[model samples]
Target: MKKNLVRIALGLALVLLTLGHSIRLYQHPLLSHLDAITYDARLRLTQPGGQDSRVVVVDIDEKSLAEVGRWPWSRDKVSRLVRQLTDHYGVQLVGFDVVFAEPDESSGLRVLERMGATSLKGDAAFLASLASLRGSLDYDGQFAATLKGRPVVLGFYMSNGIPQGALPPAVLPAGTFKGRNILFTSWRGYGGNLPAFQAAAPAGGHFNPLVDFDGISRRVPMLVEHGGQYYESLSLAMVRLLLGNVPVRPGYAEGGSGSGYAGLEWLDLPTPRGALRIPVDENVATLVPYRGGQGSFVYLSAADVLQGRVAPASLQGKVVLVGTTAPGLMDLRATPVGEAYPGVEIHANLIAGMLDGSLKHKPPYALGFDVVQVLLVGLLLSLLLPSLSPSRATLLTGAVLAGVVGLNLALWQSGLALPVAGVLLLILALYAMNMSWGYFVESHSKRQLTQLFGQYVPPELVDEMARDPERYSMEGRNAELTVLFSDIRGFTSISEGLDPKDLAHLINEYLGAMTTVIRHHRGTLDKYIGDAIMAFWGAPVADPDHARHALLAALEMQVELRRLDAPFAARGWPALQIGIGINTGLMTVGDMGSPLRQAYTVMGDAVNLGSRLEGLTKQYGVGIIVGEATRAAVRDGVFRELDRVRVKGKDEPVAIYEPLGLAGSVPQAVLDELKLWQQALRCYRAQEWDQAELQLMNLVRLNGDCRLYQLYGERVAHLRQQAPGDGWDGVTTFETK
Candidate 1:
């Protein structure tokens, strides 16, 4: 039993380990891409807006870059472009998707240094003019004052591992801050921040868009951590600035309402927009829904802004995003909607999503859904496979998979992020377990049963049985078999002084001897009711000689008990006395009870009579008692007359007998005693008590150890003193229960 437990534990452990590994494989990046595809398809089906004016991209093409010179055109040119859009075109909010960190090198600062301090007023004035021109090098002082307080947005970045450089002087307050509120998300590599541009812009946000491994931009970070402080993103900063606010004033905040996304309170901003409502995951990954390709929305070249090629009305009342979209500039990214996507377009989509209140959300119940799915799928497979045929089961499995996919799609369309890979993997595991169990565990169990029980049972019966089965379920129609009940006499007093462990050991040894005799005669061990054994001969499998088998088993058990007593004597334990009754009749025998649980048993009147007979054995002072039917069924003449006593709980008179020995094995002395007892029983039945007493006295003299002779001696003595009644049936009535 312990070995079986160890094997089961090892199997379960291996199964769990394999399941964990399979889940990890399913969560790999390739599967994530499949999940993304599924998400997109569902969104297309559900979201109200089509991939059109809802989202747009601006491109800084090769033509614009070629026409203007390599990247970073003069600040004067940038200033001119800003003027054309705001002054002439009237763009509502112009946000810069670019950064300028260093002072423009070609602004004449070197020339000013070359001029001596002793120079005349004209020379000094000339130096001042050059300095002014140099100040305009970043075109900062020029555009800075022009764009200041105007709805202009500037971009910044956050870093963790290493700073991309420092924040523009206009934003950083100096030193660092810590804890959850201090934000500047980590980043690596080197870059510069445009100090003047940051100073001029009314609001600025970080343009550090996070991309998942699948190259899809799905989420936006609201804040980032840098050094020991937190900083807002370009998109977020720009939105706050447009609202006439700065970094949010931190306080004790909570996540969003009920949806599992947390909430943050900013003293300046009114509330979180839909896009900002969701918190970034540990890796800063967010979901991005791409509208289409490069020219999907609107693209205005920098040169067009400067050359006045774009209509003033076009920028009027519009949110203008100033960023590079030039493919050669490497600002293009890969997204769901396009192979080559502008990085700046990701932010544009986020801003649009927030304004429209259409951002997707991962519902709070997603994790619950995963857990339930795993359990349900596992249990279903566990039960279903055991009862289904292979072909139909395969179809059922396919249907289940399709159903799971459909459900995942539905959840995604509802703007809930459901984990597809994990669920699919669990289902797959269930399928594998279902398939493997039949071929491996169940098959092996059957083989082991055949190997173990085949030699003991008939070949035909063996063929009909289940392998390693817990119960017998045979095709033979259910029928009641005679039940024989037996127990040791005076067991309570014998065990009173023994220690519990010793008592248990002694009882087991005594019961083991009797039980083996029953099994050897093809009896089904019904149950051990206390020290008594309730056994039946015909059950589960049929026995034609059921009554004969019971009688023979009872006789053999008495003989085995004598032999078993030897070891008990050595241990100072008392010898065991057993009473066995045998009878036969019709009764139902099969797996009877609930479908989930059942037991093989026999129940009927004949069975009850057999138990009553066993109880009567002590009253008659005999080791074995058999009902009239049992005596008639057995062809052997081993049974000798015992009594015609009415067993308790029964009104019917049963002729009980004690089996002495086989006719061939009967000794002359035993035969003489049996004859004498037979004569005494006849005398008692005839009411000839004086003659019965003479016969009992002679039998006791032959075998003083014989319990039956002593019992008859007492009966004759009692009957001799009683008056003869006309209605006397000569049946011995047991006065003790």
Candidate 2:
């Protein structure tokens, strides 16, 4: 319980730390920039890419310069271009993305006026012509006259550096905002159109975009505060004119810091048609909902507008923005969709969005929504991870992540912009914490179990237990398993004849070879006595065919002993002979033994029976002996029944047998000898001494030096002489092992 609590606490701590860090650094420039990048990707992913019929771009591209006289063309020609847009194309409104900061010098007005002022003094005829042509020579006045009261909005730039050019009055007076301390982008300087143009145009606005820290134009302020008044943006001004000259006011959300402040989030416009709410971010900025990369709107060359080459249907009732797409003009900017987007199209997109109410909303309450999302996901996973298995936990985490992404995309499609990175980071942090707990805590226990298994079990079984350590353990338990016991024949006499060092070397070599055979059949090594070996099958790992496995190991041990005989002869050592006995029954197996003397082994009557069977192998003169239960479990093995004996410490008489090999692999001669031997044993059991002795003589004739057959013959002869009553059952009883 304490460990589970600790795991939960660790998850919570990780969640709290991550959420706190994200909240504290929420305004960090790097995270803000990353958030903006994801917002841009969403915009591009969901934005409808098609021509915006309401707004059109009058591009002053390379073709325009090639056709026209070049940049800074005579103001008279510019005025003519403006007249063409208004009269010929039936344009609703015209916005200049370029500023007339300085007077047109190409008109030759200053030189002609200078000649009249000093160089051409006393020249009445030239003076009269100049005075008469004064209106025609003032090209700046001509451009201003064209702009006068025709729904023309001129664009200007707000700056942090030194202010340049003529300035215009604020659209909203300073101190007009109410409630709390509001922060908007403030500028001390601006570069605007000439005074005459400012006075002549009915509406004009600053066109500076809110280029992010990464220098990408993602948003633009709808209103900027200067001194005390608020100036409108070019897109906002254009929208205002299209809405019949609505008045814009600072809009506030209902609930806030109780300072009633929380800053400006949007702009409210009261139009004669209806009031409209223009959503803005915290900085009173609106994200630019780009329709597509470039060419989202109709594009016509300024050269074409001037030459009257455009179709009327193309420009009729369309709002036009006059801006340059030429590289020399440097009016292009980096935006979310394109690296070289015309600065003018940004205004067009904004204007079109306001007209149709398609602008994406990112209100102040979105912060609260984001916090709730992060909390719900983080806490849910943090609480859930500790209780589930690793595979289940991973599946749950994936489900939650997919849900988060699905919700975020749904909100995006609804035109509501919410942050995704914070929630993403929160999920990852929680998952990492949970996975780390599983690795450092649970895996440590698993590693210990694997090491223990390696010591007493085969590598294949060890790997199976390592995958799930709890499935196998050293705790004592009763299970139906198979046990095997093996001992060398006359080991004490052989060891006493050899030197101590030679005996040790021989024992090690023999035990090593026998162990290899046992391991080959996936049997567990229980323990080793001085000249005996004890092993079992079925666990530390489970094997359903434990009986068969033990039988195979016993058979192979004799085979390996044959291979070692040549080496033992070369060392001047007698060939080793071993007898193995196997039994299959319920036994208690685990790390048993007292604390200062512990060993992994098996216990129970079945184990004792296995040892007694090994002792009887010499009595029967056989290499392998098995109890009746073991022979019953191994179906395909060839076994010959030895006898039914009530061994010491057991009340029931148990039958024993000798296993030769698999039925298919044993020779026919061996099978025939076993048939004759079994007939002699049956005849002896029925007290037919003559028949048993005659059968034994035939068996001895078939196989010479058969001690088991000879011993049975002697038992039959003795019983024939000693029998006195019919109470004889012919069952052998072993009083010692």
Candidate 3:
């Protein structure tokens, strides 16, 4: 419970930290940039693909520039283009995406006037010609005359530099938005059309777009404030003119004004068709609804229009925007759809979207929406992930991530723009934190288990014990186990022949080989005493077949010792042999020793008997010997009973046997020899000296180097000579260990 509380606390802290960024209490540049990236991707995916036919771009393209001259062309030519569009092609409305900030002086009327004033002062014929040509030479007046009583919405630009030219009447007059805390984009000055042009045109709107920090033109301010008056954008003004010049009113959310935040969310323009509600963001801006890439609107060259090359039916009733697409004009903008997008189409897209009511919005309330979304997702995952298992946690994280993304996409389809980066980042961070913490805890436990039992057992057993660490400990406990004791024969004599260094090397090599055999059979090594090794099974990690395993280990130890013969001889050392004794009984096993030094070992009568049996192997001329308990436990092992003996420390006789592989493994000759040997032992114990002598001689003749047979033969001869009474049982007693 305490651990769970700790994990939950960590998760909640992460939630709060992420929430700080979501609510704008603090800024994380990476998260903000990621959010913008996601917004762009969604925009690209959901764009309306087909062209918007109501708007057409009258492009002053390379062909127009080639036919006509450079920019700042005579206003009479611009007037002719406008007249051709309105009078010849029957275009409904014309909005210029170009400004007439400076008067056109290419007509050479100033030079003509100078000559009339100075050089041709007294010439009557020249004066009469100039008077007749003054009306035609006034190009600005001619352009203004073309705009009079027409639905022409001239474009202008707003800036922070010195104001130039004349601005049209403000859409919302000064003091109209007093006490309203709306953050409309503001500018100090502007470069508008000339006074005569501004007065002649019905309306004009600023053609400035809102460029984001990444330098992409994604939005346009619907209403910009300059000197305490708000003016409409080119797209908004054109939209209003298309709808019979309707008046725009501010649309605010409920209680927005009362809460000191009169956030302008929509621009409400009432028209004959219906009330046109164009949604805006916190900055009173609308996200540009890009229809597609370039060519979303039809383009007609101005030169073509002037030369009557374009068909009138194509431009009839189409709202036309006069703009330049020529590269030298420098009117290209970086937009979400294309890197080199024409600046004029941005207004066309906005106009089309406002008319169709298809604009996606990110209102001021979206901040609250993002905060709620992040809080719900962050806290839910943080608290729930800690208690789940690793697989379950991973599954839950995936489901939540999918759900968050699906919900975000759904909201996007519903025309609401909410950010997803923060919530996604939070989910990933919390999952990594929880998963890493869990791994560290489990690894720490495994390390502790390894440190406790590393030296006693093989690595495989240690891993198994680590799985359930609470079940095993170093405290002493009694268990039915099998213990083994192995010692090198003639170790003292062998050591005397070699120097200390060689002796150490030989002992290490012999001990390593024997220890490998012991561990291979899953025996836990207790300790090494000089040239002897002690090991046990069925403690710390239990094995039900402990006796069988120990017997197999002893048999393999002899085989391993024999393999070292060649190597020992190559080193100019004597050949080595070992005697192993194994026994099974109840014994105390665990860490037991003094404070200065402690060891994991076994101690009991059964353990001592195992040591004593290893000492008796040389007397019996066998490589291995096992007590009766161990022999009985291994049901499939083949054994030859050596004797019934009472060792030095015990009064009761115990049967001892030498293991000879498994049941089907013993040779037929060895089985025959064992049968005859049993008969010889029976006769010798019953005092039939002659029969025992005959059988023993046969056993000797079969194998002359048989130690047990020879020992029994000498005993039988001694009994025959002494002639003891028939009160004897077959048993041998030893007075020394």
Give Cα-based local distance difference scores for all models: 0.64, 0.86, 0.90
Best by TM-score: 3
How far off is residue 299 in model 3, in Å?
Answer: 1.7
Ranking by TM-score: 3, 2, 1
Candidate 2 overall Cα lDDT vs. reference?
A: 0.86
Give the alpha carbon lDDT tens digit for every residue of 1-737 in model 3. 46688778888898898889988899888787788788889999989788888999999999999899888788999999999999999999999999998887788888999999998989999999999999999999999999999889999999999999989889999987678788889999899999999999999999999998778998999999999999999999999888888998887777233545567788889976678999999888999999999889999998999999998888999999999889899999989899899999999999889988999989787888889988898888878898899999999999999999999999999999888988888899999998888545577768888888989899899989988888888999999999999898998999999999999999999999989988899999999999999999998898999999999889888888889998899898889878889999999998999999998889999998999899889888889999999999999998988888899899888999999898898899998998998888778778889999999999999999978888888888898888777666667889998
Each candidate's clash count: 37, 2, 0
TM-score of each: 0.49, 0.58, 0.59
Candidates 1 and 2, the one with greater lDDT: 2
| lDDT for predicted candidate 1 compared with the true structure | 0.64
Query: Over 4 Å off in model 1, which ranges?
Result: 1-58, 107-109, 112-138, 160-192, 214-216, 244-285, 363-365, 428-737
What are the candidates' C-alpha RMSDs?
34.1, 29.6, 30.2
